[model samples]
Each structure stands twice: as structure tokens, then as C-alpha cells.
Target: MNQLSTNWVLGHKVTPYQTTGNYNLVKGESPAGAQGPPPHIHKKYEEVFFILQGQMEFVLDGRQSTVTAGELVNIPSGCLHTFSNTSDESCLWLNIHSPKGFQSFFDAFGVPESEKDAMQQSLAAERITDVLKRAREFDMEIKIP
Candidate 1:
């Protein structure tokens, strides 16, 4: 079993706790109500979003859906999807990607800790493209909605 914790480190706001069996369970707490990762498709892992608190707007397969507390949404593998926090209150949620250990790719190719959050924001396209390429190395495909 592969287990780990990813700290936001400077306002990234999301902490990825552990990964198991194609599922990477990420805990995110954000007051800024910021946007999330860009739309992409996963070749090996299927993703699901389980809302623990507050609300989030999820766009899957180019369609829109809202997830509130205690709700969960499944995004099939190879589907494009993205999520964002649009509420006034802080949003907390779990991003779970199946077939786990996806972080291995991130830890290997992700930007330096200092530039992580900023890079995630400013270079959304490039960053995600790099991530997708890295994921490919691990035989993982990011599903796009």
C-alpha cells in the first residue's frame, strides 16, 4: 500500500492524504473559493468527488453539476471534468482518483514547492500538459470531460 500526505505549502489549500488502488484521496480546504485543476482525461484511473463540506461546481464531460455536503459524483475514466468552489464560506472536499499512487507522477515532475500554487494558477495549460505527460509515463491517463 502506498501512503502519503501532501501539504498545501503556501495557500494551495489542498492536502492529498493517501493513495490506494487507483484512488488518490485528497482533502482540500479552501476559503478563497478558487478554481481547480484544468480539464483533462485519465487513461488508467477513474475519479470521484465526495463533498465533505460547503459546495463546489463540477463540470463533467462539458456538463455542469453541483456537489454539496455529503454528496458524491463519479467521473468515469477518460471523461473530462473540472471543479471549483463558488461559495462565500470555505469549501472542503475529497478528490478521489482510483488505481491510486497518482502522486508518484506529481512528486516526480511537479514544480518546486515554492512555485507550486502559482504555477498551478498561471500556467494552467502548460502545467496540466506536463502533468498529463508525466501521468502517461506511469501509464495513467487523465480523463477529460
Candidate 2:
């Protein structure tokens, strides 16, 4: 069995799979009260989220929906979407990006879990310029509205 490597990105503990599958699989745990990435759109891939435990509030295209364990949601390519753990407990979920490749974004911007403290310091020290630059490289556009 292959051990999945975990990274801490924007308060989420993400474990990405390394299989040569059609889609990239990332399991993420979001702490209570944590907000996910800002509403963003992926031009090249569709994203799906499956709630494994706890609950999540997903805002898709300006509509808000609360999903609980055993539920799932899909955001098509080019759709604006974001999610957060609004419940009192942490939320465990699986994120899938079709046609693969999106994991590169996490790899480039995320910090390994072991170095979370350093990552937080670096994030605070660095400006958004680096993140925006990297997002462009991954075909993701962060929407301000």
C-alpha cells in the first residue's frame, strides 16, 4: 500500500492520492469554523466534493447549501464555488478533480503537515502575489465577488 502524503493548506489537512487515475483524489479535513479557498473557478476541470463526516456549507454560484455526512456535491468546470466547515465539529471530505493535474496547485501552494507552523509564518510573511502567480499557472481564477 502506498502512504498518502498530507499537506496543510489554508487550514485544511489534505491528503492527495498518487494513482494514475482519470481524476485526482484529495481527502481533506477542515477544522470547525474554517473557511475554504475563496470562491474560485477552474477553467479546465470539474470538482466534486463528498462529505465523509460532519457538515459543510457550500456556496455554489451564489447559492448556499448545507451538506452533511454521506452527501455529495458537484461543481462543473467554470462554476464559481467555495465551501466551509460551519458546524461545531471538524469536517472530513473528499475532493475530486477530473482529468487529474489539479493536485499540482496544492503541491505548489500547500505546506506539508509536518511544517505547518513554518507554513503559517511563511503565509503571513508573504503577500498574495505569489499565490495569484501560482494560481494562474494552474488555470484557476480567484473571483473577488
Candidate 3:
């Protein structure tokens, strides 16, 4: 398990790669009131989110819905989607992306929990900007709103 800290509220546990170019799974946790990434669309991959703990509010293609533990949400390619922890407790969820490769985005922008010095180095290297600049290379498009 590779632990990733994307920010104060978002944490990710990346499962080891088992098959190349097939799929990627990431276990994610967010504190209450935490907001996810800005609405975004993937041109090449389909994404699925499974709620494992608290509730989350998902906005998909301008529609908002609440998903609780044991529920799942699927966002197809080219759909705009984002999610947030709406309950007053931390929410645990799984993010699965088909056709793999989305893990590369997390690897590039997320800070490894055990590597504090690496985090600092990444920060100094302007990782977020780099992520935005390189997003298309991973078949992702981030929308600003």
C-alpha cells in the first residue's frame, strides 16, 4: 500500500499495480466537509467510486446525488464529475479507473506520506502546475469552476 496525501483533507492508498494497462484501484479517505478535485473529465478512462464508510455528495454532469456506504457511482468517459464528503465524519471510498494510467496523476501530484523530504522537493518543483500542464498526456482534462 502506497499512502498518498494530496492535501490536508484527501488521502489515498494506492494498490500495487497488478496488471499493466488494465485497471487501477485506489482507496481514498477524506475528512468531513472536504471537497474533492474540481470537476474534470477523462477522455480515455471510465471511473467508478464505491463508498466504504460515510456519505459523499457526487456531482456528475451537473446532477448532484448523495451516495452512502455500500453505494457506488460510475462516471463514464467525457462526463464531468466531482465529489465531496458531506457527512460529519470521515468518508472512505474506492476510486477505480479502467484502462489504468490514472494512478500516474496521483503519483505526480500526490505526496507520499513516508517521504516528507520528497514532498518538500515536489512542492518546490511545482507539482500541481506540472500536473495541470501534463494532464492531457494522461487523457484527463481538469475544468476550472
Residue 98's C-alpha lDDT in candidate 3? 92
Q: Residues 45-126, candidate 1: write the lDDT tens digits.
A: 7777788888888888889987899999998877777777777887787777677866565455444434547435534566
Clashing pairs in 2: none
Could you give candidate 3's per-residue lDDT for residues 8-96 as a string of tens digits? 21233333334445788777777677666668899899999999998999999999999999999999999998888767898888888
Off by over 4 Å in 2: 116-129
lDDT of all predictions: 0.65, 0.83, 0.73
Model 1: residue 127 alpha-carbon error in angstroms: 5.7
Residue 64 lDDT, candidate 2, scale 0-100 = 99
- Superposition error at 108 for model 2 (Å): 0.4
**Among all windows of ten consecutive residues in candidate 3, which has the lowest summed lDDT?**
7-16
Cα distance off (Å), candidate 1, residue 138: 6.1
- Poorest lDDT segment (10 consecutive residues) of candidate 1: 2-11
